[model samples]
Target: MESSRNLKMKFDDLFDVLVKDLTENQPADTSPALKWFQQVLLYNVPHGKKNRGLTVVQSYEFLIGEKKEMSDEDFKITAVVGWCIELLQAFFLVSDDVMDHSITRRGRPCWYTVPGVGLIAMNDALYIESSVYKLLKKYIRNKPYYIDIVDLFHETIHQTIVGQCLDLLTSKEVNLDGFTLDRYNAIVKYKTAYYSFHLPVACAIYMVGINDERSHQLAKDILLKMGEYFQVQDDYLDCFGDPELTGKLGTDIEDNKCSWLIVQAWSKADNRQKEILKVNYGKPEECNLKMVKMVYEELNLRTVYEDYEAKSFQEISKLIEGIDSCLPKTMFNEFAKKIYKRNK
Candidate 1:
């Protein structure tokens, strides 16, 4: 993998081009609506690690072979499509912060939390979403797979919305009964996996002229499973990881999130442990947080997580091994390795 510095430089270049294209045609008068729209795009669309967007370009290069020479236009178009995926992510995140009542994102105040922005962030989120198609039409409307690309984006966004709805319902009520492993899988697969893992690679696949129905389904199967494991690790890290390394303190316990740790701890708890959890699991108080952590330790949930990681790695390996060369196994392997054993 390239250094983060190199990756950031490349991604920033792509983002710069995208921002220019979006704003270059603005009227010279610069109306308030246009100004706010520019700020919305600038602030929300390009922040974060940008791994999801970067994956699209990287996966495509892997499929086409790094040694193979790609034209300047080919490279730029792939990078722009990658940025479009990032715009979609920005759309989800801006609205999610509003819905989740989150304070900060990427180390700054969320767009909605900024003074005077208020609920206007909702409309800004929609604008970011619409920009995805705008970028697509501007860059690749003439490509053979243009319609397929549009359809894939539409489907991925819809799947993520379904996952978000499930997550909202799960977290809407603070009942422990609702936090099941099955529900957790559903939420992660749709909300996080489809867009993060499946969409990027699927776009690359379609771009490279490999559109076999069976191949797409097989790739989805592998990627969706990888996405589930990726999210389970995210849940584990949210509660158990070091805040210094993670860049944010975990609120899953206090927030009553349907986290993997809680479910595992619940399943392993004794009667007294269960009662302790019942009293303290979702409380915002420091003592309640302490009590939940104590129970998690008693249940050895960290070890359980370590074991799950091993099992998941093995499963993904076996699946990748079984894949025929419809798409390059190396492409999927590279993607999987990035998420495997990640701490943040």
Candidate 2:
């Protein structure tokens, strides 16, 4: 608990550093843009749980445990990279809310929804992405793995954009036939897994001098599996989660997202249930929403998700055990434990 608290404190302090460096140090002539960008970062960057960013720090610590304790400078460098991950996360969310026409996020109006923001949020997202490299160049360029980190971030961003494109195309048509597990897997793997799960740990690996294909492939394989599991949990939370607890209203149903819940519901539903879903699945009206929820409850998707969650947890645990390298199995375990039965 103490370690977690200290990490949280460090993570918050890093946000202050990022905000100051990016927003306060610019030329006075650039102050308008810089100040606007500051509000963008203030609203979007550091609000969430910070799990992905902190994973970089935690994974680095785990990988280097046998070597030596991290110096304060080492910790700051890792946290800077971690905050870059958070910036990337913010970029995605801010832009996604705009694309999805979402209103709320993290228990508040999304950056795009805030007064005077609207579509300007897209430019803010661009600023966030550009700042990622600036911060990286300033903080991490001296490291041997500098180029690798840059390439990894660019690659993951492209993958996420492609996933978002596929998601938009897929969701454009609300046919129940479109929401398959295969498409769902593709969407989540590209959209959420690469950046959220693999990239941070990959950064840690490169930093720790574990850059071999064998080790990275192993880490990517396990992490993507866990990432898939995590997204399924997210899909479950979207439909069933409390807005007060989850900090945002779910729009998957209204948006016709290729979510795991809809896919499972479609697969298990009978003809009558399918008809009800066909009538109600994609509409934003409350009556339609209630009908969709009724179908889900009647099918008992909550129970189905509970079973799948338990099974996936067991499967991922075994996958962690099957690791055959010098890579730390406990690091994978730590990642797994964070997501295994999480509520939010």
Candidate 3:
């Protein structure tokens, strides 16, 4: 695997340039407000593992192959596009923390919880989202594929919001009487897969001049499955990962999340086990969380996760094998390997 640290240093340099531009372009007298706005933007962005942004550069590299050398100007432009994806991610996460009533993100206080930010964090989130388009227009507007890139950004945000709506709706309708595997899959695909896994690479493909329908469809098919496995692993980690390393306690059980574990447990549970889940899950107390974990252990949820992890790896391998190597396999393969057994 390539060093994520090395990729991240390059991203940080790109991020610094963007911030400097935003700062330098502010109104002469009201620089303080710009500083605050910039601070909010910078703080919220750049804290992730940089996998999404790096996927853009790596995918572009794969697509271009050896035909064209990556010019310094090319690297800078692609890095900006990658940063736009990161900004979009920040937009969702800030608002999501508020919606989830989460207290922390990336190990700091959630933006809404910071003193003096409060509900304004909602606007701040929007500002981050707007910056994505602004940067896109600034850097890529003259390119022949400019319209396609703009359309992609809009489509990705729309899909993510729709998925989020499904997720919120599912949590509200957790009657278990109505829960089914299909519904669970729908929630996963929309809420988690599209933006996290598909959109970033798709954006790079468009940049690399591979905007044809067939190429897009091929990338989406593989990326969406990768997205599913990514979220499934995330669901698994919530229960079993080290909190010291993962940086948060598992909340899916208490939040009544439509996680793979819960879905599987519900599917296989007897009537009595179902009743226990109904009574104990989502109770908003430590004791209730303990009860839920107990039930999970009783159901051998660990083994279930292990089984799924192995199966997901195999599925991804098969998908990659089916891909024509003429396409950018290294880019997608790099992403797949990083998340396959990620601990944090």
Best model number under lDDT: 2
Query: Model 3, 226-319: lDDT tens per residue?
Result: 9898888888888888877776666777777777887888888888888888987767888888877877888999998888889988888788
Better of 2 and 3 by lDDT: 2
Per-residue lDDT of candidate 2, residues 132-207 (tens digit): 9999999988889999999999999999999999889988875789888899899999999999999999999999
User: By descending lDDT, how would the candidates be arranged?
Assistant: 2, 1, 3
- Worst lDDT 10-window in candidate 1: 1-10
> How good is model 2 by TM-score?
0.98
TM-score preference between candidates 1 and 2, better one: 2
What local lDDT does model 2 show for residue 186? 96
lDDT of 1 by residue, 1-344 (tens): 44557756877788877877777787778667677788999899777778888887777777778667656676677888889999999999999888877776776788998999999999999989998998999999999999999999999999999999998888766567678888888889999999988998899889989988988998999999999998899889888877666655677788777788888887788999989988898788999999999999889888999999999998998899998766788877877888888987
Candidate 1 regions with alpha-carbon error over 4 angstroms: 1-8, 27-30
TM-score (C-alpha) between model 1 and the true structure: 0.94
Kindly give the stretch of ten consecutive residues in candidate 3 with the minimal lDDT sum.
1-10
What count of clashes does model 2 give?
Answer: 0
* Residue 318 in model 1: lDDT: 89
* TM-score winner, 1 or 3: 3
